[model samples]
Target: MQVVIGKAITYEQQRLIKIVQKQLSEIDKQHLKELYEVTRIKHEPKDFSINEVKREIECGKDIQSLFQLANTILPQLKISNESIKYYASLVGYYSVYKLK
Candidate 1:
């Protein structure tokens, strides 16, 4: 996306590029958040329950704490750092969303 944005040759093009970038960012965030929710529900972590994580997602307090918990548990499930980071950002973004 950055590469494409950089290719813009006009002022209007740049503005449109920014809008596209912002929209893509929001879409990425939504996908990540959904993935985070699904991952938590699909896997039972020793330190927490699926319902507990769901409740936390609802309240959105300590989203990073949930990220930390995901960081810890993902490795046990043999998930890669890329996946952990993906889910971590998903949880982290949920903090900004503030559904409660």
Candidate 2:
């Protein structure tokens, strides 16, 4: 029996996709003990900036939804959900620098 299945990634999922991409940029500068290139995520666009992800979060988006989104995007990239949220939270922490 062959069954075709596709996952419905939501708006929050899209936001997490952006968050994961932004987080990767900062982590890329650090010395990773593991070769993260093997863990690189492809579908999320590089153009989605931290500020953009922040906008999504600031627009009354819930954290639980964001976490669910994170699960979908980062699993393929081999990143854990906790690590994903920790990095995404930095978007709020470092938001001042993002303001021009």
Candidate 3:
């Protein structure tokens, strides 16, 4: 997930990005930073929308905090119930995997 940072992000999107970055490991942050630079050079749309940010956070490895974040932000995003269920399942799968 490379964010292009093409345009000025809204305050909500910025907040979501900060939360995602906070949840990321140092290694993942470094990797994403490199990807961000490359995507910016390629002129790709790396700028994360609020929804995209929510999706990324939903799929993050840190299950507990990520799930909590999702619960907190999804409603704010006004995402559909189906999308919420999808993310919940993804979180459940990852959480189980981590327990193995």
Candidate 4:
């Protein structure tokens, strides 16, 4: 019975992780799209892939690592530290939701 309950809990956690991943992906897509639009309007579009950045974030990279990646791809765009923190927080949330 205990083994069955443990398996059930693990399964539920996996399900939640999938659901959260989907939701976070959608949110990141929308967020990146909006940022891209703004940058385009300013005639300073960065040559970066939103999907790639999202993948890196989802892979549990540290916030410093994210900033490093962002700096490499978006040197001209001044991304505030607060904004990085916000993105890091989202990654942290996703990580928590992905626990099994």
> What is the Cα-based TM-score of model 3?
0.27
Where does candidate 4 stray beyond 4 Å? 26-100
RMSD of each: 12.6, 17.2, 16.6, 15.5
Whose lDDT is higher: candidate 2's or candidate 3's?
A: 3
Candidate 1: list runs displaced more than 4 Å.
Answer: 1-72, 95-100
**Residues 1-100, model 3: lDDT tens digits:** 1354533346556776676666667755554434322222222234689866665555453334434544665666655799768854553345333422
Question: Across residues 1-63, which tens digit of lDDT does each residue of candidate 1 receive?
Answer: 886666654654566446535544454455445544543433444557887667656645434
TM-scores, all models, native as reference: 0.24, 0.26, 0.27, 0.27
Q: What is the lDDT of residue 44 in candidate 1?
A: 43
lDDT of 4: 0.48
Counting clashing residue pairs in each candidate, in order, gives 0, 0, 4, 0
Query: Distance (Å) between predicted and true CA of 77, model 2?
Result: 1.3
Q: In candidate 4, how many Å is residue 100 off?
A: 12
Assess candidate 2 and give its lDDT. Answer: 0.47
Supply the global lDDT for candidate 1: 0.51
